[model samples]
Target: MSIGKEILFFFGALGAFNGFVLSLYFFFLTQKKYLSNYFLGAMLLALSIRITVTVFVYFNNDLPKTYLQIGLSACLLIGPFLYFVLQSGIHSIVKIPLQWKLHIAVWLVIIMLAGFWFPYQNYPILWNNYLVALIFFQWFSYSLLSGFENRMLLQKIISDYANAVPAEKWFGTIFLGNALLFLSYFLGFSRVPFVSCITGAIAFTFILYLIILVLMHRKRTDDLFVFNIKEKKLNQEEAFVLSQKLEKLMLEKSLFKNPNLSLNDTAKELGISTHQLSQFLNNNIGKNFTTFVNEFRINEACEIMLSNEKLTLESIGYDVGFNSKSTFFAAFKKHTGTTPLNYQIQALQT
Candidate 1:
């Protein structure tokens, strides 16, 4: 093998090993509700598969033509799968429906069957791979776009948190790493295979490192045991002040129109740490960040629904920051104890 091929294989092997270990950690250590764990597992599995293919190609004197066809086809599919995993993870964090899991499972089964049954046919494998890639790519792009929207939503949430907190650095780092990884894969498929593979592996490594760091930080801070008796009293006073400020800011700014708002984003906008914002919301606001933000959104949505007789329910729900009509209705019902349409009807009757 040439020096370049040797170097590529070396990195490939390292990436595969790292991915396997990290995936195992994610699978075993993290809570199952965290969708990122599944995404990590999928990623690690894909990396392991790549490593297997690389070893086969390098050790064997004459690669089976079928292997090459299957390997390339698999690699193309893996790129989009990785993106989907990341997207799903983010959606899960925002409590959104991960409707794509079923589709992903079906596609994986089809791909595996194709690889097993007709492993050598280049056209069939390539065609299926291309079709899956197209679908995955569109979904991936939509997820990224959602992330951008979430940033704005996060800002609103932050404003409601205290107007004194700074944004967490970790989120920015993770977002950048993800973007780089996506770009690397795009470049890889655009003809520069070697560069793409090396860069993509590096990007994956960075993302894993970020996840590990977050886990470590959470562990060190004793995140789950919130009953520190000594600190509780002091924190209570601070929380009260923060909550009042945050609530006032939210009303002033009319921030309920942002659908992707998050507690972390709100904390940053307020120039406070997420922990502090979370504490304030819990102790003073008498609600979790999710509920607090949803309440505001639902209230705004009710006003819009009542005043706009010509607007459809779906349009009004979306216009006021609910990602879907169902979510809007659910949140509205939870907050006001009435369905959106019924509430509107009742308001009109009155």
Candidate 2:
């Protein structure tokens, strides 16, 4: 083959190869086992399989029909996986829902049965002409649904790209990449003279790299995929009751005095799930657990400093539930905008 064709093949195949490795990394090697990452991994695996077949077929027209069938079968999953990636990421799903499991199971059965009934080796014409179009349309439909899932982010990206969150933009880029990839394949399927199946593979290579660049540029690789539950809305009455109960409990029991106080421990004390307590702290009080607890600690620390000027800051930090003097100083600076010594001096003068 000429150098130009060899270069095209190398670039196209490299994307699929790297994508497959990354999928495995996310699936079993990543330390954090997030559901969103699982879906993203699955989507990558599907894309790699499809793109591999496309590249091979573009270079070799006589590729086995069974390989084409397998590739197209993988194509059927790309859309659902794409949707799940967005849905799980946006919703912060911890456990895979039953509906999601069932959705995938049903699709798996459908494709398996189709392959069984109409083996592509015998029905190449139908698979190539009719089923390929169906697969592409299905993929496109999922792409649209994915857009709907992230509609707010898309609007933000379009209206105020400058201010949109890095994570949101990263996700939007993935959706746009998928759409552009579909366009490339659709053009080839339409028998556009200059476009070939390999065009989609080439486009995917560029899209894949662009996605990686966006992820790296934003420095969101860690936080973006980390599973933090979507904050739930707490109504005013419930919020008021919870806040009062929490404050009273903390004041009466001094739970924050424990240096190792945890969200789970506090939630158990409050007779609520950790999720509810987190929601209350985050939404109603506009403070995370640490900040809420630190406020009490800082208040007590200030009172102690005023009562006995001879007490050392290190002792005061431990007495006030901080695990270390440095943490106490940092939190104090963050909440009070002053060092412990400066705060004490200012208070004495006042």
Candidate 3:
């Protein structure tokens, strides 16, 4: 190989090599097993595998067909992992949902079935002419979808780059990097004379180093990648408005009476995310979701007991939303500093 080609190959191979090692570090060496980190690991692994193959094939015309198939198969995974990495970080998804699992399973099945039915060794023409297009399409489609889904974050970074948090800026860099890398490969695939096929690998090397620079500047890449998703904190004005709304909804809807009410359900009724609602309750109200809801139930129970001396303790418990007598008595005592029976008696005497 010429010296120029050798130098180009060195940088490209270095990027792929570092990426593979980083993927392993994320997968097994990280102290915390965050889902976002796991997705990031998978994304890096897929990109490294695809780029390694690209670099080799660009240099060697006689590379084995098996390597070609492996590279394309890894290419199919890159887009999905990219989408998942962004989403899992943004949405604070700690666990893999069933639908996400099913999505991955479906993609895996399709790739395996295709490879089994038309082995690249036996049907090189079919793989090259038709399957390659399909693979690239899938990769492009998911890349576009990922950007569309996370456009708000991108816009935030663009509008306020100076004040944007490290996590937001990190996310934006990743999205833009992926887009550029995809464009580089797409230009090569389109047979643009100016853009050589090896540009993709070179672009990837630059992108990877750029992302490393971002991590270095932040000095908190650990927190960012692990996705300690900073909940959107409410300002004083927003907090007051949400607090009032929460009280109004609770009083009007009597949501605590349902007995099956959950933090998620209450957050939905208040038109806020669960995390925001939880933060509001804990930080502003000085109570957790369970304690807050129980307070309401206990207050209502007291009102009922005072209004109607004819009701039994167990009956009053059920009337005010407690599903079990023991739970009702326990909460009543906790809030009032007396059992339900004692409180009722004290109230009647007063």
TM-score of each: 0.48, 0.65, 0.65
Highest TM-score against the true fold, candidate: 3
- Candidate 2 similarity to native, TM-score: 0.65
- 1-350 per-residue lDDT for model 3 (tens digits): 99999999999898899889878877998766878778888988988998999899889979888888988898889899889989998888889999999999998998899889988999999988998899889999999999899887787578546434456667787778778878888788889988976788888888788866765586345546643445556688988899889989989989988877877788889887555676677667877677788898998888888888888999878877789999888888888899988888788889
Over the stretch 151-223, how does candidate 1's per-residue lDDT look in tens digits? 7434544445443222223333434555665567567656573564456665665566666666666634233
- In order, the Cα lDDT scores of the candidates are 0.60, 0.84, 0.82
Per-residue lDDT tens digits of candidate 2, residues 184-207? 888988999998778888888988
Candidate 1 ranges with C-alpha deviation above 4 Å:
1-7, 31-33, 47-62, 65-101, 113-175, 192-196, 209-218, 221-274, 278-350
How much is the lDDT of residue 55 in candidate 1? 50
Ten contiguous residues with the weakest lDDT in model 2: 159-168
Q: Name the weakest run of 10 consecutive residues (lDDT summed) in model 3.
A: 219-228
Q: List ranges where model 2 is wrong by over 4 Å.
A: 214-220, 226-229, 232-350
Give the higher-lDDT candidate: 1 or 3: 3
> In candidate 3, residue 328 scores what lDDT?
89
Q: Is candidate 2 or candidate 3 better by lDDT?
A: 2
Prediction 1 TM-score vs. true: 0.48
